[model samples]
Target: MPTLPISLVIITYNEAGHIARCLDSVPFAAEKIVVDSGSTDDTVAIATRHGAKVVQQPWLGFGPQRNFATTQATHDWILVLDADEYLSPELAAELERRLPTVMAGAAAVGILRRSTYYMGAPMRWYRPMVGERMARLYHRGRARWADVRVHESLRWEGSTVDFAAPFHHLHNPTLVHKQLKVLRYAELKCRDWLEKGKPVRMWQLPLVFIAAFLKDYLLRLAFLDGWRGFAVAHTAATYAAYKRLRYFEMRRNPDSVALAQAELIRYRLER
Candidate 1:
């Protein structure tokens, strides 16, 4: 196999169901590294068996963990993928064909991420809800992950080009999984806001939820997908509301911070 001068870096917890498929999809990676924050499931063993160098580290916030993973890579060019996301065959082939030019000049490459919901339908129009174009493939020297708890992204000053194809996101396999994910993300975002001393705008909670729903369903054209669109848009709006609610709770009752931290740790260890 002709490999690109790129290293694939993935961060995982209890992703036994998705890790192997993600690893197998990127044969063009010159190196593959999985940084696991103590998965009680078979994530570590499975990743190691699939030709990834597994590194066991305690959980840091998302951005820091990803930046740490980049340090473990053998190549300066980095390809970041979540445990549940994998490159499509067309996307992978496109990367192999264009990456050399990308590495020579571009700061990073952004690819469209098409997600599959719990009901198993691949969404055609959820871009506004999730910012479908993501800067996943980049050079470590030119771009790095932002230091945020939730919604961490790549930060770079140079120009980024978009790829023609999209990668697949096997998002939230079940209802329970989706619920837990929202809660976990809400808590993390709450903590980030608290640390920054940002006050919760009480009036914006309901307004934000409404805006998120309309953005997803109407502006993004998710309504074209019928019930599936409604469900995903509702979920996005719920997440927006829950995140603010979590912030208000933690800010008003400082004592709850300890409980929230414990819950987060438990979720990471057990999930």
Candidate 2:
């Protein structure tokens, strides 16, 4: 089958372990661009070997990094993917068959993502409140990622369509790995809030944790996935709590904020 006139844009830092699978999954892309921050590993070499045009860039937060990658694409239609994410066979086929027709009237294509946990089976429900629909494929002119430090998303106007398939997300497969990521993400979110001059909400910690847990476990139907679902909800609640706790800590002990900032810089370099 001939490839589509689309460019695959990915941002990476020390992603050698997963880059190959990510690059191989998108065989339909006419071109692939990898905007990599300094990687101590062989991430750049592996991407280059896989026929991707690799651009060296410094870490610029999650949202900014993705936006910068979109600008490097040769094609107007872009597919933004994470190093741990790839298209499932059904989704790949659906994308090739439907994208041309969808693009005629839609600004972006929202694909459902099926994510796994701790090397276990993929969860049937993961954060349903937020919706599993991810706007990954889009015209760069109409969509761009929000300039946030952590949880970033593409914002766009006009009509949008959904692909009736699920993209595979092989997320952190171990508890240790997941915990480290949670810490990093929570810190980043706290930093963003601090930068925005948001006040510390110490009193809301318990309420936030309870609300987040119930939202994921009950409202999101995470219970359907069994223990894995419970773990997911529990972890998510912990994250919500931690972000607030970090803010509270930073406000009480200003020196801790500097330590976290240094840790974040180290994480950016090594992550």
Candidate 3:
């Protein structure tokens, strides 16, 4: 059978520094659709300069943005990518050689997204690597990102493969951004937990934090990456702690009327 020509899709938002590097890897994709969520930076220009079609849209969260990117594509088989991620050379060659044969039965392709993290100075003692095998390439209608706002998985409906090649994900270049991103994720996660009626015991904070720390930093072998590992371990624990703390804040009902006004003001400022 002839090979399945594919389209590579990417979602971007203020990713000026990384978009060009991302689009650089798959120049031969039959089509490349970049769904942007109002990037004030040159992300759109960079993608367009690379011969990709850039579609600007509102911030609709992660899963929906990705799904919208799929809708704008011109082909059934899609190679979904994050603007901060890029295909490694080994994966690219393997995908070009074998992807077509496996395209039909496979609803998605699993690729390990190797993350790189840094501190104020690229922490030699605590670098956390991306430990995820995400479903990227798939049939047009076979899968979509789940509705959950944080750590959402692909809603897939068929067989998958443990693709050996890794996808490079340059997560956070500095400690400030890293901490900020995790906190944002923590807020979303707390909302998810609250929606599900999850308990908000103060004790649950340390327990969940420690457990998540162990799973990612130790069990997932995130420590193998050295400094990046320690940072990840620490961040995972911090995020859990923050989420549980927020949950308690709402549960216990902080009765300071003045603070309530301040909270609303802060919320408006952040948004």
Q: TM-scores across all candidates?
A: 0.93, 0.92, 0.82
Tens digit per residue, CA lDDT, model 3, 51-98: 899888775666666777778988888888778788888877778777
Candidate 3 Cα outliers beyond 4 Å, as residue runs = 1-4, 104-131, 222-226, 252-271
TM-score of 2: 0.92
Weakest lDDT window of 10 consecutive positions for candidate 3: 119-128
State the weakest 10-residue window (summed lDDT) of model 1.
Answer: 109-118
Number of the top lDDT candidate: 1
Error of 3 at 243 (Å): 0.8
Residue-level lDDT of model 2, residues 1-271, one tens digit each, is 6888899999988889999999988888899999998888999999999989999888788999899898899888898889988888888898889877766765564555554533555665556522367788888888889998789988987677777767777778787888988988888788788778898768898999999999998888888778877887899999999888888887788799887778767766223
Candidate 1 error regions (>4 Å): 110-118, 128-131, 267-271
* Candidates' C-alpha lDDT: 0.83, 0.82, 0.71
Of candidates 3 and 2, the better by lDDT: 2
Off by over 4 Å in 2: 115-118, 125-131, 264-271
Give, for candidate 2, the lowest lDDT window spanning 10 residues: 109-118
